[model samples]
Target: MPAVLAHAFAPHSHDSATKTDAALESSRHGLRALVISFAALMATAALQAVIVARSGSVALLGDTLHNLADALTALPLGVAFWLGRRAATRRFTYGYGRAEDLAGIVIVALIAASAALAGYQAVKRLIDPAEVRLLGLVAAAGVVGFAGNELVARYRIRVGRRIGSAALVADGLHARTDGLTSLAVVLSAAGAALGLPLADPIIGLLITIAICLVLKDAARQICHRLMDAVDPALVETAERILAGVPGVENVGAVRLRWIGHALRAEVEIAVRHDATLLQAHAVAVAAEHRLIHELPHLRAATVHADPDGPPGADHHAILSAHR
Candidate 1:
């Protein structure tokens, strides 16, 4: 690292301590909301499952399973959020923010597993039909669960955005799945009452398939996060801004990555090496300053200097002839 660039890291790395404190404070409120949401989901899950068992409604049972899974998933999300806010130690210099991503991976896996199991049972039931009873009760319970989940989802979403917590977003997604499955359960219950008992198991299987597809998508997102995949848009924007810097020749390579909550970029540029050391340093500092001002996400930038020989000198050929 150039001497000028060496000090470049100081500005943002210092603020990391402040961000850690802010994260800790924000997570406390988020955790409280999460706990309440978990309790509500668990109660709804048990009530829906009992109603399904009594009514012999396969659709309702599957919907209840979704709620139960959502409830279980919240605990880990809460834990991950709390852990993410903790201060970085020697073992974890980046803190634990990645915990949310890990929790999301686990949640998607669990939901997919449950969906596969439900689908298998639904397929077996389709092979040999069974009489369903009290279809109205099953439908009513499903509606109740849907309403409850929607309420919880709304609050969770608010907290998530307020605190910038990805785990909170995952929890909201879980609640949304419950509400959607409940609607399907309501439809399947109605169909069963109208002498289309096969629709109950069929709808159950479809809901399961839908959840599995969602989990597959979630898995892809988690993989991208873990890989630290650079967002193309951000990289393109940085390239544009870096290229526009005064006194800069062809901008060579640009790399953007996360240093903490804030995004950081390492930029390379070719400049006249013959320029006074102070002049090159000033130009580099200007470039770095402009990038951060233009894009708040950019945490740091570095410029590499190259000697600017006299024009038309064929500097490369002169070295070649000497060899």
Candidate 2:
């Protein structure tokens, strides 16, 4: 019998149970952050909308819309995280992890829409100027919006990093952008108070441009996740773990990708050419075990065993071609 085999490290129900529990725990953390942030944003936006009505600051109105969009974004992300908890199906071998990335795309679209709307209003205000009233109250509302968004941004970023969630991290960054634009509302209020009435709309235009920059960054992050780009350090760590396995003579290709917040790997290890099939299998298992033990986020690993005599692909190709 051929000594080469591919084995999934998870063979026991206990391991599956533990992994499922961990995934659920991660999802819970994300959900909690989303709920709190959404509520905070909604309250902040409502307060600011009241000010927008009373003061007629186009800049404040723009900030209010951004805050509302930010709050609504939590809904899709919450659903994505929930879907990510679902078990893999025959039709969807990787489960619903990709939904997180799709949610991220939706966020980017929403951000773009807010930018377009803000820019349009800003340009209209520039063409037909309006006196901004109650400048002090508008500034105060901007401060409130900034405070709420910054708090939510910090919480989401901290939890997202802990759980290894790219989508959540992007959302946090988006909130940070909104907070910064809220500060731009303060600047607009200040300019209006100083009698440069046109400054308010100009600041709104500038805020719109800044939002586009943030949108570019968030889209880049989401695209990287969709493209299966894991950190090089993670790949190095996997290789090191494989090398430390006693019977592994050589470490071949090592690949890691994130499915939602969890990571899975496919690794190739070379064992002694003269080793028995049982010995090779034992070596592969040991390597797999060490990988799972050392990498906290690694949920599953597929280890491929090959003879130590030559490179795995060339040897397999030569053997198959000869046969």
Over 1-323, each residue of candidate 1 has an lDDT whose tens digit, in order, gives 57755443222222344544565666786788789898888889888888877887777777887788778888777777768667668999666767777777888877877787778778878998887788888888889889878988988888776665545765687688679888998899888878997998998898887677667766776677677766698888877886898877667677776432345566776557566666666666777777766865343454544445567655357579676
True-structure lDDT of candidate 2: 0.86
Error of 1 at 232 (Å): 1.9
lDDT of 2 by residue, 129-248 (tens): 999999999999999989999999999999999887878877887899899999999999999988899988999888888878987998888899889998999999999999999999
Using lDDT as the measure, the top candidate is: 2
Instruction: Name the lDDT value of residue 159 in candidate 1.
Output: 79
- Give the best candidate by TM-score: 2
Please give the distance, in angstroms, between residue 131's alpha carbon in candidate 2 and its true position after superposition: 0.7
Off by over 4 Å in 2: 1-15, 310-314, 318-323
